[model samples]
Target chain A: MRNSIITILKKELKRVFLDRKLAFAVFIMPGLTIAIIYSLMGGMIEKLDDDAHEHITVVQTINMPHDFRLAAEALYGTGMIIEENEPTEKDKAVQKVISGDSDVLLVFDENFIGDNREGLPGVTRYANSIKDFSIRGGYMADSVLESMRKNILSERLGGVDEATVFTINREDVAKTEEKAGKAISMLLPMLLTVFLFAGAMQVGMDTIAGEKERGTIATMLLTPVKRSHIAIGKMLSLAIVSLASCLSSLAGVLISLPFSNTMFGGGFNFSDLAYGVSDFLLLIVQMVAMALSFVSIICLISALAKNIKEAGGYIAPAYMVILVMSMSTMFMQPEGVWSYMLPIYGNILSIKNILMFKYTHTSGLISLASTILFASVLAWLMVRAFYSERIMKSS
Target chain B: MIEVKNISKTFKLSKKQRTLDGTKNKFKIAVENITFKAKPGEIYGLLGPNGAGKTTVLRCIATLIKPDKGSIIVDGSSVLEDSREVRSKLCLLTNELKVDPNFTAEYLFGFFGRLYGMNDSEILKRKKILFEEFGIDEFADVKTSDMSSGMKQKLSIAISLVHDPKVIIFDEPTNGLDVITARAVTDYLKKLRGEGKTVIISTHIMTVAEKLCDRIGLIIEGGIAAEGTLNELLEKTGAADLDDAFFSIYKKTRENVS
Candidate 1:
């Protein structure tokens, strides 16, 4: 039995690794494509950010007093192109804001400086709400008018302190590193589960179902090798291959991690996650177990199918099932030890625990054990399938 | 020596299979109460037309599938009770089973040899002998996917013989081969028989059974219609050749196609 497993494992490995085209397609292509696309996207996003920062908002004002215009010109001159000495028609100035030519338009009454008439002077501010530039320009114009009012009140009332009302102070107390770790914990579990299964699916279907379709599996069965050994050997090799494929794609993402902030339009670093070596080791185990569980499920399904196409037909639904199970982890908190003892979801929860610094060795090991046990059961069923004549039925 | 005693097999037909076969019965009896023995140093052939259960009998002996009743013994090991032992002593080759297209003949030869529990030096020696015997040495490096159909067939035959088993089984050995490749296979079977191996085959071809098989069993509708030497069959049917004798018996014992 040992010899049979070794023989089958060697042959399977050689089938993939010795063929240059197959090796490249399965191992390197996924990572390379992700890296290339991420770089291209990141570069374009950074350019747009730089362009938006350098823009100057055009503020157009009408029917303003000379003193008030001078005060506004002194205040926002750096980022605003103030045009108080230009055209003063309210409709004409408002048209500029509507056409996207000017960012903001402010119009006041003809005798706005005389404060003893009825009450405060009336002013109308117009800017396109959809455009960030116009919205920002309008806010700047409001602040300028408020400052003039404050200065006038301070001189008449004999104190700037009385005109300013009670002052308020703002404070933020969020932990940056903890928040970053929480984000990783929530997303990494779901993504890791999806990727491990996807990698296994990409090759698992072809390994068993394709061989059955071509009648090559029968050639192996024709030997003296025990049927169970064939099952174990194939499943073990598949898990290793799936892990390799997953890691390849992960490496692609890792290589582009420095640029991911710009690529995804976010500013958080994964390095802020202060996980110890033991936590990383536990995460690695969970990942391997997850890969095993996924490959075993696919192989069990593939064994039931007579051809690769039929295997694919069956596995597409299984993918949805794994997806739903993995996606549930995104919205759920770890419930209990039992919740961490489910199959794929268990592995995901364990990874989540490790990321969020809530992991216990007992729960982590239980999750790993449960995943392995599930995979072993599936492997046993696949062995029974290999022993049966159903596997030999081509049509 | 190989002995198959009173073996019968029935298949449960799926709904679609029942429709295609136009049969109301849920089960189709593939073989029934069949008995045969193949001794060393002789090539025993199961001769029949399509669906006569010739391949089924060969498969039963190879332990690819089980007989619902009865038993098959290869040497001293029962096919059902000691399948691995029987398999270690036997090899089955069919057109449907093939080599991995991604691998070369040499690599697969070593692979199967090791699966049969041979050491590296033993596999090297055996591979050299088989590869040269069947002229597979010329294309040992070529992948089965890239080789011609005839070459692939030749490679499969060479690889099957890597263990050099005591019992040799072939199903339609030359069903889809050129004259030269078919000749090489039949000649190899003859050579194995000369070395005192128990050789059995199933075929619908008249010339193969007439020229290669030492003894022939005529099968019809999943039962043995007649069993004897070529001359004995000719004498029994009062016919000149195997073709006439087969038709004479077929006409007597034929039933529904299924």
Candidate 2:
């Protein structure tokens, strides 16, 4: 490292770390805020799920067979209450369901007669689809009736063994590690990219544009140090700082995982991810490269802007573009060698492949190389801006 | 010694700037054919009004901005081709340039000194001398934002001189300073000049120009209207003092520019 570059880098680090309030806002608050929000959101969603599960529904039945009560009890579980059929008119019974007074209306055709042995009788179920209680009641009613019919068919065939021609069994053969990888691969890559970009932006705008606005940059520009060194120094310091923020937010996500398990269907522990040290190391390396690209882009934008507000305006669209790219990874699979050369999108896909245990060295190399090339170009542009007129414009 | 040779700079104006400045032209000529020399052990002052291209010329000489044409040489180094070497030889103090507000005086001094490639002992020695002279020792550890404006200005001067360069350039040296602080700053410039340093400053104050400067260049409308000693200016303009001489020159220069 050049001595001037080291001096500049040290000063940049000192500017952030020496102020306790700024350090906390830049480093800890982003992650802490994310954890609190995720936990709160997870709690709300879990509560909704629990409520829908536990609510008992009221069922109104017309001419329901008495012989089916035992079958219904065995199949429907405890969330439904079957009302005694009080000889109510059919129209009135349906009106009860429509008015939301009753959860479901079960109408047995006249031919059912408790002895559909002569002719198969139809059962019509009516319930509002929009209401959670009505929807559950409708499902329960269908399941109970279906169970009774199957039982009757079995009895008529003289034995359940003779009733079934063949059995179809279903099982998941995927390992727990594969299951976890599948679960996290859907979300983690996009989340990581967004978090890392946010971390980069938090300090990057102030590093250059803020200095220009305050006229502090011209003071530094008067120094004998090379302008390229100043640009690199600010960029390196931002990468390190933003990476710290990204790690903090990652920790927050990890901490919130247990609380959010209900939303993801609680099951195996984190050990199920089953990543080795090499896997973790590769992931970190890819993420660090991604951070470099983010820092380079942010520095370039800041260098072009006259003040922090203008820098923010220019940066917000870039953030949205990256966000859309990362989000596109959710619905996509790593396709080919060409896909790994598409800048930020490629890096995210590569990260997704790593988590899903689908990464190849060729894919990783292409992604890393493309990112470094892109970031190098941006870093070079930032240095040029420092050397030219754009950086000195103050409005 | 510092020599500014036929430097010219023009700024492209944005729509907003054009409207604010009330000019239809797309470019504003900041400095044109500006040339001067400041020798060791002498004070050379650029006497001009606010928009007379004083700061622009100084900025070009400081290597902060490149001129559209021509060059500046500071201690035998070209500002354009050898900017880093030129910057190493000269120091600029201006109201528009400032240290970071978040930094303490002591830290900034050390930071800039290190940027100049000074060892800690050399920085400490300069700090001891400069801080004491500027009364900055009392608030050396205080953040620039928390300090008074006078204190901040003084610290800016001290930090600019951390390398103890051969050429000293100040723009509006007494701007935003109290009388006492201004006097202290002027006295320090004199001491620096006495130590065989080349000192150039831009000011509109006739009294400061008359008393502080060994020679004066009257700049008007991006051009040097006249250049002479105070006595020479008085004699040439047929005026009794620098104030009368300046107005006589200003009227003639404005007529010529129009």
Candidate 3:
């Protein structure tokens, strides 16, 4: 039995490895294509941010107070040199802002520091909101003026404690780790499930359905090997091959993390994505189990189909169903222990927990057990299909 | 020896199949009460028209499909109870069986050889002889898809015979081949018979049956109408040749059914 299974696996692997086109599609394209796409996206985002910075212009009124002027200069840094322009008339500065030349116009009343706080003159600000850079510059100028107001109030009130009125200080459990965990937990699980299914479908649909369509299955069935051996052999080889294929896509996701992060505004540093070796090993276990479950389901469908075209038609709906199921990880929070009993959902949740460094060994084990149990049942169904002449020789 | 005893097969026609077959009945009888035997050192030919249950009988004997009733035994092994043992003793070739198009003839030979538990040396020895005999060695490494249909047929024959089973079943062995290739295949069947192997084949080609079969069975409408040596069938039908003998028997069966 072992020898027969090995022979079948070897033949399947040879079929994939020897066919250069199939190899490229299954093993190389997923990673390489994603990397290129994400890198382009990253470059576009960086360019947008740079363009926003370069086009910003801040304008100040001539009678701007010395303290406020010093604070503005400190805040703008080298930006003040390139962007600051003295306007001979207040109307001209307003006009410049309206014309899109200047991003913001700041006007101050010459109150000369009157102690009547209620009647004190206020600063008037104007900017074009249609231009994004103008809105950003206006916000910056607003923040600086608000700080000056707070300083004046503090001085008048004999430097009263700000905490007595209102204050907020964040206390998170390891902020950097929390940020990385949240980002990866949400994104990686969804992408992992998608890639795993995509990989399995690429090869699993062709495993038996293609053989039946091309009439090669009769030759295989005529062999002396047991039907169970054939089923297990096919599932074993498909799972391993698909795991490798999914890993290629995972490599794509990992290698392009920085770029994808910038695109999605995750802003995660590459080092923040670090997972320990043991954590990765656990991930591999989940990957293998997930691949097995996917291949078994796909193989059952493929065997039940009359031909490759029919198999393909059957598989598209399965893919859509799985994709929708996996998408649950994005919006739906993982439920109680019952979530670990679900098939694909369990695997996704387990992966999410692992990425966030929040998984317990008990939960991981339950997820693996559930996936394998489901795979075993599906594989048994596939074997039954192999022995069903009505299904096998339908055409 | 091969024995098929009253084996009948009925297929439940799916809606699409019913439409294609143009039948309102849900069941189609592919073969009924089909029985035949082929002894060692003799060639048995099943002669029938298209869709006349010839391939169905062979497929049952090959264990590709099960009989709805009765049983088949190949070399003392029941096809139903001991299918694996029967499989090891026989080889089946049909139009419905094929190699992966991307695989070369050599690769398939090795693959099936290993499945049949042939070690590397045994596989190589058999491969060399079959490839040389079939003229497969010249392009043994070329993909099956790249080969001509005749070449692919020849390769299929070689792969089927990799384990050199004692009983060989072929359905329409020369259905769509060039004259030369068909002759080669017919010659190979004779050689197998000469070596005292049991060879059962189905063909509608009168000349092929006349020239190759030591005994013939005329099948029509899922049942055998006549079975005997060519001379005996000719004598029974009071016809001049095997072709006339077949048509006469077919007419007699149709009249009886009516």
Best by lDDT: 2
- Each model's lDDT comes to 0.84, 0.88, 0.85
For candidate 3, what is the DockQ-based docking class?
A: medium
Score chain B of each candidate by TM-score: 0.97, 0.98, 0.97
TM-score of chain A of each: 0.76, 0.90, 0.78
Alpha-carbon runs more than 4 Å astray in model 1: A57-179, A263-271, A324-332, A335-338, B255-258
A1-395 per-residue lDDT for model 3 (tens digits)? 68999999988888887899999999899888878888888788888888877864566564577667666666776564223335458777778788877778776666535655567577778889788877888888876777667766777776757523777898876667657877777767777788888887888878888888888878988989898888888888898888888889889877887676775456666576668999899898998899899999889999999887888899999889888988888789877898898987888898888888888988889889999999999999999999998888753
**Clash totals for all candidate models:** 0, 0, 0
List model 2 lDDT by residue over B131-224, tens digit each. Answer: 9999999999899999998989999999999999999999999988999999999999999999999999999999999999999999999999
Tens digit of per-residue lDDT, candidate 1, span A1-395: 69788778777777778889878877898778767776777776877677666778787777776655665767866667777734436677778788888998877766777766677787888889988778877888888888778877887788999888788898756566666666767656776777788777877887899999888988888788888898888888888888888788778776766665564336777777677898778888888899888989999988989888999999999999889988888788777789978987888888887877878889888888998999989988888888878566662
DockQ of each: 0.81, 0.76, 0.75
Task: Report the C-alpha displacement of residue B211, candidate 3, in angstroms.
Answer: 1.2
DockQ, ranked from best to worst:
1, 2, 3
The candidate, 1 or 2, that scores higher on TM-score is: 2
* Model 2, C-alpha of B200: deviation from truth (Å): 1.0
Candidate 2, pairs of clashing residues:
none
Model 1 residue B101 lDDT score: 92
Where does candidate 3 clash, by residue pair?
Answer: none
